[model samples]
Each structure stands twice: as structure tokens, then as C-alpha cells.
Target: MTTLDNGTNSTPAPTLPAKPAVSMFAIGTAIGAILLTIITAISVGFSLGEIISNFGRKNSVVEGLLNPDWGQIWSRRSRSAFIETLQLAVLGTATGATVALPLALWSTTFGNPNRALRTLVRSFNNVIRSIPDLLWALLFVTAVGIGALSGLLALFFFSIAVTTKLTSDTLDGIDMGPIEAANASGASLTQMLRSAVVPQILPSYTSFVLYNFELNLRASAVLGLVGAGGIGARIEFFRGRGDWEKLWGLVVMFFLVVFIVERISVTLRRRLI
Candidate 1:
């Protein structure tokens, strides 16, 4: 309130800052994205009507999912397959994660001082990471005979990519004081990393390894479909025979195993972190 010369009180009008204008670039980008999506959908012959019609039909897959043969889990063959899958996951994670630490270190600036070598390693990591686990399974199956060996190899590579990528990220944020001190003390590169770097990142790295194991366990089932040997092979067998009930049952069992293992992994990781 303000007092006027005439001794009358007066109030000033409240004011607000003006809203910022939306950029044309953002609007254009949104419009372009919408247009691209519509074009891609049309190009792919996407049809909502066809989808609805198909869903309305008596689909055996859906029926199988609805009424799965839970008894499949009790079969001796299923038990064997489950064991194979577990073995694959364990072996893959153990081997891959073991090597991943070195690969991760070599890719970093602190770990690998040579810029060219670091770039090469980074490129290699990127290429491997780009390939999905299924593709890796396919490649190994082609190179090696289709069996548990192929699956093991695929999981090994997949685990390395996952663990190395995670460990590298963790390495990036570590305290550099110990590293500088190690360098000033004339420590060797290996000694410096072991003393300064390894201690700091061990917990996070272990957590990543455990996480990688969980992923490997889940991926093992899919790897078997390509004849890499695991529960997926059994799943493929049931699928080939049109035994959707049995397939669904195996799927359910796999899910349960994965869920339990993931819970255990999460608990361990939480403690480590």
C-alpha cells in the first residue's frame, strides 16, 4: 500500500514475469517424429483391424498360456535341462566376469595410457556390446558345433560386455587422490591399479558381476533355442512338437528360477553396494 499526497491509501497492481515462448525447433522435431512414426507404420503394413481380428480368433498360444501343463516341471528331462542351464549361467558369468576387469581397465584413460590402444579397446567393447546375446549364440553355433559349448561361449562374451561396461563406468567416478599418490610414489602401473583403483571399485565391481550372473541365467534359456544346449533346447523341442502346454509350463518354471535367483542376487548386491 502507498499513501497518496491527498492522504488516501492506494495499492499497486501486482505483476508477473512473462512466460517463455516455446521454440519452433522443438515443435518441428515433435512433428517430424510423429510423421516418421506414421510413415514407418504404413511402410510396415501395420494394421489395427488385422490385430483385433487375429486376437478375436481361437489362438492356441493364448490358450496354452491360459492353461499350461504345470506337470512338465516334474519331468526328469526338465530337471536335467534346468541343471544344464544353471551350469551354463555359472560358468559363463565366472569366466566372463573374471576377464572383464582387465578389459574394463584397459579401456579407461587412467588404466591404459596409450590413446590409440585405448581407442581400439573401446571400439572392440562397443562392437561386442552392440551384438545381442542371441546373435552371439548364433555366431558361436555357426563357428563351433551346436551344443552347450556354443551357449557357454555366447554367455561368456555377453557377460564380459555387461560386466566390463558397468565396471568401467564405476571406475570413472573413483577418487583420484590415491591414484596420484601411487604415481608420485613411483609405483608400477599394475601395482598402482591394484593398490589404489581395485580397492575402491571392488564392491561395485562385485555387484556388477552378480548382476551379470542374473542376466546370464535368464539368457541361457534363450541360448538353448539356437542349439547352444540348455533349457531352451527343451523349450524348442516342445515348441516343435506343438506342445504349447508343456512349453508354457517350462517357461513358468524358468520364470520362477529366475525370480528366485534375481532376489538372491539383489540381496547380495545390496549388501555389497
Candidate 2:
């Protein structure tokens, strides 16, 4: 407010800040998400009545899960299958993730200057990732005659998809300073990537590889259902004979192993980051 002495009146002059603008895009996105959730819920038959009606009914699956044998681990076959699963996960992650590092690097503009090459690499990665792990297992099983080799092949491509996608994303956010420095120092593309880029994303890349291993471990169990190898085959055997107790017992034991591995991997990943 300003006082006008001559007229004995008060006059006020002020400026008000404008309100913040809202984005239509954000509003549309929220609305779309809510609608999608509702549609999905309806399509999946989500209902409290359905859940209540199905609860506590006696069934083979429930009974088996409840009364697990808990001694399947003592069987020689079970032990061998567990070891094979471990081997498949380890070998698959190692080989696939190793290749993924280079493939991921090549997908980026900084690491690979050629736009054509980058597009090709990304396209290949996308194609590999589009195939589900089980489908890959089935395909390999058909091609390779249902063995550990087939399982390994499935896990390998799956690992490539997981690790490369993660590593490539990390590459996008790396410190451009070192990249620029390397370029100024007349470093070759390979040298610049190795010295500047790889070091920046190494910890993250390794953590992703460990995470991929955990996933591979779980998938390896299922791959055996398609005869790709691992304890899944043993599980299928028990399942075929309607030995619910043994099947559930085997599943429980296998998950326990996976849980332990995940714990270790998670710990290591934490340290890495």
C-alpha cells in the first residue's frame, strides 16, 4: 500500500507471481495408468468372493506343499541335479555377460561412432531379449536333444539380454568428462572406452551380472521341464508320478539354494555400488 499525502488517500500497487503450469502429458499419463490398472484387474477376474470361495479347499497341490518330504536333498540324484543347476547358472552368466559388456559398449554412440553399427547391435539385442527364457530353452532342447548344453544355451542368451540392457543404460549416464579427455588425448575408440567408459560403469555392470545370475538360477530350474537340463527334469519326473511331496520338497530345496546364492550376490552387489 502507498499513501498519497496530497489527496489523503491510500493507493496500492503490487505484482503477483503467476501460478505454476500443469502438464497435460503428466495428467494423461496418470489417467492412462489408472485405466490400465482397472482394465487389468477386471480382465484377471479380481474378486474378493472368488478368493474367499477358493480358500482352504483340500487339493493335491496344497497338500503336497503343506506336507513336503524335506529329505529330497539326501538323494544322490537330487544332489547331482542341484550341482548341475549351479554349473549351468554360473557358466551361462559368465559367458553371456562377458560378451554383453562389448555388445553393450558397441550399442552406444560414444563407444561406437558408427550409427549403422550401433543400430544393428541394438536391433540384435532387442531380438534376443524379445524371446522368453523358456522359449529359448524349448528351442535349444529341440535343436540340441535336451541336455545341459541346451539349458546353458538358453541361459546364455537370457543373460546377454539382461546384462547388455542394464550395462547399456548405465553407459548412457557415465561421466562425459573422461570421455572428452580421452578424445582430446587422441585415444582410439577402443582405448577411450576401455580406460574411460569401462572404469566408470564397471561396478554397476558387475552388479547387473550378479543380478542376472540370480535370475538364471531360478530359470534353470524351469528349463529342465523342457528337457534343457538342471533339476527341472527331476522335478518333472516327480510331478509326472504325482509325487506331490517329493516335488514340493525338491522345489523348496532348490529355492533355498537360490535364496542363499541371492543373499551372497546381493551382498557383493551392495559392496560394488
Candidate 3:
């Protein structure tokens, strides 16, 4: 080694290689994503525009809404029809929710000790959920004849499917630590679920129930389209006679009732969650 005057040979300072040209890659990716989003939005906008144009030409929607017959809505017959709608919703939701509780519990692995049983229960729940409410209403209407009872049955099945799905999901998402603690303290499965899981998931359960109630209200209003009963029947009656004013009045009344229910649901949900 050659010795320098003062000393020690030092390694040359390592030069940092120039950073790879990643900026171009990042910019290109961002540009591509933006372009894709723009294209998608334009496509959706065009489709919506076509729909709006079609609706405007028909004039059914706007005419019905703007020239609603407020006098008809305030009439005794209309009020009675509205009340029937409310009754169908309330009774249907109550019965459905009651039935759903056991199904929801059975559908979840947390409640079902046997894996095979859990799978079977979950499959059954899925089958129920796959059927749309309108289809259910149509089927029940044929079976029970066109009346409020048919509407109630349709709503009941719909609510049960919805509640079971939601409740099972809520149960699955619950923290298991509390449940384990309860079990460790010599609690039975039922006791653990009642004391620990239920408390944790009650808020979510209540919220789902409220949501189902809102859905049931809308469903009840339209059930009469299939002759299942409620204001839907009244709407269909007027529609057949070409009484656009009365039809519009029923539509407006439905809108008002749904709006009120929505407000109450929101307030209750806020307090809950």
C-alpha cells in the first residue's frame, strides 16, 4: 500500500445512482386512470341523457308529479288507503323480524357449533335473499288473491330475508373477546350470546330493522299493483279509469308518508349509532 503523507487511505464516497425514471411511469398511470374515469363518466352521462329524453317525450313522470291532485289526497278514501299501507308495513315488518331472528342466529358460525349446519343455514339464507321483493309479491298475490293479506305476506318474506342477512353479517363482525370472556367465566353459549354479543350488535340490529321498516312502507304502497292491497290498489284503480289526477294524488301522498318515515328513521339512527 502506498502511504499518503498524513495517512489513511479512504474509500471513495459512494455516488448514489440517479433515481430511476419513475416519474414518467407514475404520470402515465395517473393519466390512464383519469382518461378511463372520464370515458366511464361520459358513457354514463349519455345513457342517462337518453333515458331522460325518453321520459320527457312520454310526459308521464313529470305530468304526474307537477299536476298532482292535492284535493284527492286529502279525501277520506285516500286517507283510508294510506292507513292500510301503514298497517301492512308495520305488521309485515314485525312478523318478518321475529322470524328472522332465529334464522339469522342459525346462519352464522358464531351461533352454530357445527360447520356443516352453519353452511346449510347460510345457503338457505342466501336462497331467500336471492328472490326480489316484487317477485315475492307477485307470487304471493297469485296464491292469496289480490288483497292486503297478500301484500303482508310478500313484505313479511322480504323483511325476513333482509333482516336475516343483515343480522348474520352484524353477528359475524362482532368482537369475540367479550364472548370468550363470558364463556371463560362459566357462561353457557346462550348466556354468552345474550350478554355479550347481543349488547354489542343491538345498535346495528335496530338500524337494520328501521331500514326494513322504510322498505316495507314503499313495498306496501306498490303491492296493490299486483292486487295485493293498500294505496297501490287505489292507484291501479284510478290508473285503469285514466284518472291521472287521482293517480298523481296517490303518488304524492305516498311520497309524503315515505318522507316522514325517512326523517324519523334518520333521527332514530343518529341517536342509536
User: TM-score of the candidate numbered 1?
Assistant: 0.93
State the RMSD for candidate 3. 7.8
> Against the unseen true structure, what C-alpha lDDT does each candidate score?
0.93, 0.92, 0.85
lDDT of 1 by residue, 1-273 (tens): 123432453546444545679899999999999999999999999999999999999988999999999889789999998999999999999999999999999998999999999999999999989999999999999999899999999999999999999999999999999999999999999999999999999999999999999999999989988989999999999999989999999899789989999999999999998
Top TM-score prediction, candidate number? 1
- Two-way lDDT contest, 1 vs 2, winner: 1
Report the C-alpha displacement of residue 24, candidate 2, in angstroms.
5.5
- Models 1 onward score TM values of 0.93, 0.86, 0.78
Residues 1-273 of candidate 3 have per-residue lDDT tens digits of 223322454655554555567688899999999999889988877576788789869666567777878788677887898899999999999999988887887777667788998889888888889998878889988887878888899999999999988998888788989988998899887887788778898898888888899999988889888888888888988889888877887788688879999999989988998
Question: Candidate 3 versus the native: TM-score?
Answer: 0.78
Tens-digit lDDT string for candidate 2 (1-273): 122342354434443555668799999999999999999999998998877777756779889999999999779999999899999999999999999999999999998889999899999999999999999999998988879999999999999999999999999888999999999999999899999999999999999999999999999999999999899999999999999999999999889889998999999999999
Q: Rank the candidates by TM-score, best first.
A: 1, 2, 3
